[model samples]
Target: MPQSINCRVGCPESEAPNTETRAWSESRKMEAMPSRCLFLLFLSTCKLSPEVVAEVQESSDGPGAQEPMRLTDVQAAMEFIAAAEVAVIGFFQDSEVPAVSLIHSVVQNFQDVSFGISTASEVLAHYNITGNTISLFRLVDNKQLDLKGEDFESMDATKLSRFIESNNLRLVTEYNAITAIGLFNSMIPIHLLLIMNKASSEFEENLHRFQEAAKLFPGRILFILVDSGVKQNEKAISFFKLKMAELPALAIYQTLDDKWDTLPITEVLVEQVQNFCDGFLKGKGLRQNNEAKEKTSKVEL
Candidate 1:
């Protein structure tokens, strides 16, 4: 949190309610720096790399417009604003000229998004009839800008910090057999496995399955995907004694008990994948036969 922007009594402030704050669109308050300077400011405050800045600057003006959803009225805008931690508001300078700035303000009742205009109530005031459109950018926790004040000019490098510090990501990274052994060592106790050729459809299907699973389980289970076609994978293939033809197979690795199981499903559909995952949780789907194990085993990486 930063010092509130002092403005008209009803002005929108960033963050908490009752904080005396002004609108970022208050041109009198937010001094316009050169494009290069503003670019550098974004680099420092937003923790953007030089390459990203260069890429942004390379664009003629800016990226193509994908207009954000606009709030309908004051009631809707107030509701939208109240729910957000941080929001960016876009305002039109005239009929065509548009500009935006970040704000942390508690608001209530509007349409699809929270909105504010320079007015009497100091709350969401509908400007739709006036042809003034505003867009909101909801900035959540994690890598985010934490400036010292509501004024954009006040942002300094020292104030920027990461909200979350732990490495909780669950995406499956590319790996070979040797690297796989070292990788999963630190993973959470329970993990699922998907073995498929990187160039094949099975790889994509499995990837989607794991990513979707993340929405529900989050860090509870790890999804590791391995490319079974590579030379590095051959060692794992031999370790599991899998034949050449059975390339794509699914398995689950339980680190707590040091066990692995071959999933029963031959096809990688969403429902079947979920059921296989459920069965693995129950400790039911282990390799049943030596012949079946030899065909399905593609040691997880």
Candidate 2:
């Protein structure tokens, strides 16, 4: 016995066919077709050209240029500094290297800015007493102000005391000679202050880790990481020495902590250490393998 299946030439078996039903079935067949095939069918049906569709596609995916950052206005700068918590002061010294000072700062007037530090702050003394002509800047929101012809003067004791009271900053009790004062005629955007503080905090944490590593490895390893936030010359050098002394290993100094993994130690020095370690490990492995082979041979004999 055999079974036979039959299909009508122009009708679907699922439903009864009429003019509307046949038209709907034809539309569904066309919709189910591949896009390229449908496009060809559409062009054949409408007698339209392919260039129009190609133009539309190009317009949707075209490349565009990004807008540049606009330079901030004075009012924007004032508002930024008024709300800032930390600032870096850049100054030039007798040495070729520029000095950077990080301190708690405040903005007074639109044109006048002030920073407070103990009179004993070596950085302040160097600029004020040493007659160091330094350029000061403030950064916020990736905006920077390059302050030219900046000057620093001692704040009156009464004003200093008032500033301390207003800002709730601690007065140095032990150093009566140290006076706190504000810096005026400076330039820096306020938003950058916050960014600098965040960066400095991260740098300090990485620096602490580097110091710990140095202590563990001693003379066998040396680490060098620089802290850009460290503005005081003596303090920066002292910190460097303290970290180096922890390990009798080679000297390690860091210029800036670039998130810890990639240190900016001299490239040549880093290569040397890596090569040495690799060779030492290889040699040790070879010796172990040789000893194991000797034992096996004796057992076989």
Name the candidate that leads on lDDT: 1
Q: Residue 119 error for model 2, in Å?
A: 39
Q: Write the per-residue lDDT of candidate 2 for residues 1-301, one digit (tens) a residue.
A: 0011111211121222222222212322332222111000000012223543332233223321011111133332223223322222333333332222212122221112333222223543433423333222222111122222331233233322233222221110010111101110011100000001214435445344434433333223223332233342123222222232222122221111100111123122334445433443243222221133343221110
Error of 1 at 119 (Å): 35
Q: Would you estimate the TM-scores of all the predictions?
A: 0.38, 0.15
Tens digits of per-residue lDDT for model 1, 1-301: 1111222111111211110132111211122211111111010123444543333233212331122224344543333333332332333333233222222121221122223332223232342222223333222211111121243233222211111101112245444322232233222455565667778756666678666764444335556665666665554444334455655666665554445565434556667667777787787755422345555334444
**Backbone clashes counted, model 2:** 26
State in Å the error of residue 24, model 1: 55
Query: Per-prediction RMSD in angstroms?
Result: 18.4, 33.8
